[model samples]
Target: MTEPQAREIIENYLEGYNLFDVAGMLSCLHPAVVFENVTDGSVTLRTNGKDAFEAQATKALALFMERNQSILAICLNADCARVDIKYFAISAIDWPNGLKAGAILQLTGQSVFTFRDGLIASIQDIS
Candidate 1:
């Protein structure tokens, strides 16, 4: 893929995230896609394949009463992209020891995307 094509894919994925559109997000990923999520320098979640990703995405989306991902910067080559985002969300349910329902959360994060066959093969998110 060209650099712009890679960037567009990333942008579309981000848009899906902001919209809580699991199908839209999955469309940008390869069938065997891998996803890793890190928070505070620790890996919080990991999943492989479209089915696993869809399950996680659905669960994660349900926890957010409102969510938005605002892209701060994007850098891309032919096969890789890095997206910096300002993320905001409000909890829809209470956690065991985390935020309560309706609590607002904000974080800055980066998602590194790897592409193969014109689709995202993997994504590693760090915040």
Candidate 2:
């Protein structure tokens, strides 16, 4: 895909994520899409295939009462793009460490997306 098209696909996916629209997000991914989440330089979660990814997304959404992502920047090259985002979420649970329900949390992260046939084939998230 062209650079603009590839970027648009990523943008759409992020928009879906902010909206908690599972179907919309899934529409941008390939059937065999792989999603990896890394924390502290270690792989924390990995979901393979569209079905698995959908389940993971649903579970994540359920943990937050509200969630949003603002795109800080995007760099596109060929069929890949690096997206920097400022993510915010309000937890639905009260944690033992004093984080209470409805408390907001903010994080800055980057997602690397690889596209195949105009759909996202793989995504790796680092925060």
Candidate 3:
């Protein structure tokens, strides 16, 4: 894949994600896609393959009443793309940890995307 191809794919994925459109997001991924979420140097979530990714994404749909991910910066090579992100969301329901519904969540993070067969093969989100 070319750098421009990677950028377009990433943008498409982000568009789907912001809209909570799981199917659209999946369209940019390889069938064997691997996904991970890293927080403070530890892996908080990992999903292997599209089925697992779909399950996770579907579950996440209910956690936020609103969500958006804005790309701050992005660089892409044939093999991969790295993006800095500003994320904002509002909780849809109370959490066990005392986060109440309507609470605002905002954070900055980085996401790495690797490509295979002209599609995203892996995504690692770090914060």
lDDT of each: 0.91, 0.92, 0.97
Best by TM-score: 3
- Model 1 clash number: 0
Residue-level lDDT of model 1, residues 1-127, one tens digit each, is 9988898888899889989999999999999999999988888999999999999999898798999988899888768888898999999999998779999999999989999999999999999
Local accuracy of candidate 3 as per-residue lDDT tens digits, 1-127: 9887889999999999999999999999999999999999999999999999999999999999999999999988769889999999999999999999999999999999999998999999999
Question: Of models 1 and 3, which has the larger lDDT?
Answer: 3
| Residue runs of model 3 more than 4 Å from their true location after superposition | none
Sort all candidates by TM-score, best to worst.
Answer: 3, 1, 2
Model 2 ranges with Cα > 4 A deviation: 95-98
Q: Kindly indicate the candidate among 1 and 2 with the higher TM-score.
A: 1
- TM-score of each model, paired residue for residue: 0.94, 0.93, 0.97
Q: List the residue pairs that clash in candidate 1.
A: none
Runs in model 1 lying further than 4 Å from the true structure: none
Model 2, CA-based lDDT: 0.92
